[model samples]
Target: MNSMSVWEATANERPKRPVLQGEKTCDVVIVGGGFTGLSVAYHLQQRNVETVVLEKGVVGGGASGRNGGEVLIGYVESMRSLAKKYGRAAARQMFQMSLDSIDLIERIIQEEDIACDFQRNGNLLAAYKPSHLDDLKREQQFLYEAYQFESKIVEKEDLHTELDSSFYHGAFVDERSAIFHPLNYCLGLAKAVERRGGTIYEHSQATKIERVTPDKVIVETHNGRIVAQQVGLFVNAYTTGLHDVIDRAIVPVESIVLATEPLPPALCQQLIKHNRAASDTKRLLYYFRRTADNRMVFGGSGRTASKRDARTLFDKLREGMVTVFPTLKDAKVEYKWSGKVGFTFERIPYIGQLEDGTHFAFGYAGHGAAMSTLLGKLVALNMLNEGDRHNPLDRSRLKPIPFHSQHARAVGIMKYYFKFLDYIS
Candidate 1:
């Protein structure tokens, strides 16, 4: 089987760009070329700002292309938890931003005329256990009562119309959720950035960032440098010593995904009738969807170490897929790959300026598909000194994760804990 992501295999050819070669200057320099960085660049260019984006690899080489392609709403933390911690009004605003993020994706696709198989068929959150269904019911009610959002709960008996498998007790369907070809979307954004006069350089890894003055910072790449008035760090899970403060605040967890060979159209319909992206209600969750070409794309995270062999992880994921859909036991696996997800201690993404005045945003905790886009736009607005009134992320505190040096072991332990919860519940 191929070790490349299905998105990478099927996506249109990404336009080539030159690597940064020498010293340059721009109004703002962005690190990383994933969704967040690309979105920031796109928005900044719209405002006619001189922006340059530097990527160690090609666009979408990170989690932007490696994700499950579930264009979902809301944060990794539940709405109830957000409300309890940050008051009802603030929680509602955050949730509205999540919804707005989805709208932003649709708007960009329509205005830019991006052909990325964007669809709003909706999303399904399946209940792994009977008790899990109760949680879905409560969540549905909370959304309606508090935020005026509507979602339908599929009873166990009615779930067959939505899914062919009996693995889930029930499910919550959010019609607002959508799905698309993630890599294509990223490439389209890259093109849009260029169309608007923004510059992006691939294979230009930023090695060091030094503040030369109060408003000027020099970003050193392997072969070049950029002097900018402001810098935005959008390197999420790929964060390392490049920015120690932001790196310390994130915990990287590896997630693996596998894709089956294209199945018959009827079989694909049987697997997921409405073709909605779906995920189970588990800490170590399993998310699956039907690709545009009728392939079954399944992804999940488990207790395995990140250093484990790709084939071993593929086998484990295939086992889980077979358990969910017995008829897929003999399905030919075609693609397998993995990427890291960034998680924060609070389980909420943060956006703010660092001590040295470097604007930053990250730590999506596996919900980066939409949140990253929204945060990127907000970061641009923050940079432009506009719309400070509507940005909730600005109020968030970015604290270093406690005991972060042992985060890998901590994630492993949490995986087992979540497994036990899945078993008992």
Candidate 2:
């Protein structure tokens, strides 16, 4: 839409609040007000827990607000890779968790009456090469057999109706996936949390942490400090200078997106007939979909925030869109922006307690829209004396990614190189 960027095009706008000053105490302290932290506050407040959330900026001002808004049915990483790393059953469990996360998100939006422009349109996992179909075929079979889900595999000729892209050879359509306005979702969740007695302080940055005991943590922010028995860090990409362990495991991978002007009805119908979102199979991939107002929102990799200029990157994003719909080559791009995504070498979200009393849930690896909120609920439940039965995620073996410090720079370089490979391969 011409209204705003896809991240900002949503109808809901949050009411602002002043930052915290002086000192405050709470039963639990949460740093970062993105989807993860907001979900933590929401769940904790529902249980009548005294909780406070501190954000360096507005709620969902981080990757939670800056993503492509595709709530897909699987992990950010491929299921084949996950099965190789964690075994088949674990991979299946992880996949099930993602599906459950999607359901949980929808439930929260309906129960809270948050108008986030959410839709249940299925996602098309298209294949760019013939070899890529191998993974998709295996995935479709695995999903049906292991997860009891139905997905249709379309051949190359059949893909024309679904995707105008001649590049894709085939695709697997998963009806369980959906899309939504992520920023509005975060804002609505934060407001609900506040309405339930949880306090959220924006522009309040957590600078230092003091472990009062094995079970208590005191978090010091710029203007105030929070003393609590438990603390949570949901700041993923922005975790720089906060914790060395997190900094090493998490690298700030830049993702850029461009929003085109609302297309005419005929063009919109030609682009996506059923209003489904589509993302191709590639290592360094391109994810694009139409918004509620018919504007195309496209996203992919970049180097830096400033270097990824909107004017220049908008052309690049439009090129990808044109590859999907050749007629949209001359489409007008209205807004372009970029945000940092925290990526771990392992590509699995790491949720565990630090040596101190701080409990951390991060490294969603860019598929956090659903998983982050689910993790927030688990984090709150674990902190609120919930039994292991109530906790769905397996956190017992959660550990930080390895080879992160020295290998981080190399990983970035390798990522760009592999992106090029995917582009050519």
Per-residue alpha-carbon lDDT of candidate 2 for residues 124-196, written as tens digits (9 for 90 to 100)? 8889788788778988887777668899898888887787668788988888888888898888898899999
State which candidate has the highest TM-score: 1
Q: lDDT of each model, Cα atoms only?
A: 0.89, 0.79
Candidate 2 stretches with Cα past 4 Å from truth are 1-4, 9-11, 305-313, 387-403, 406-408
Worst 10 residues of 2 by lDDT: 387-396
Error of 2 at 314 (Å): 4.0
Task: Please identify model 1 stretches exceeding 4 Å from their true place.
Answer: 302-309, 395-397
TM-score each candidate: 0.97, 0.93
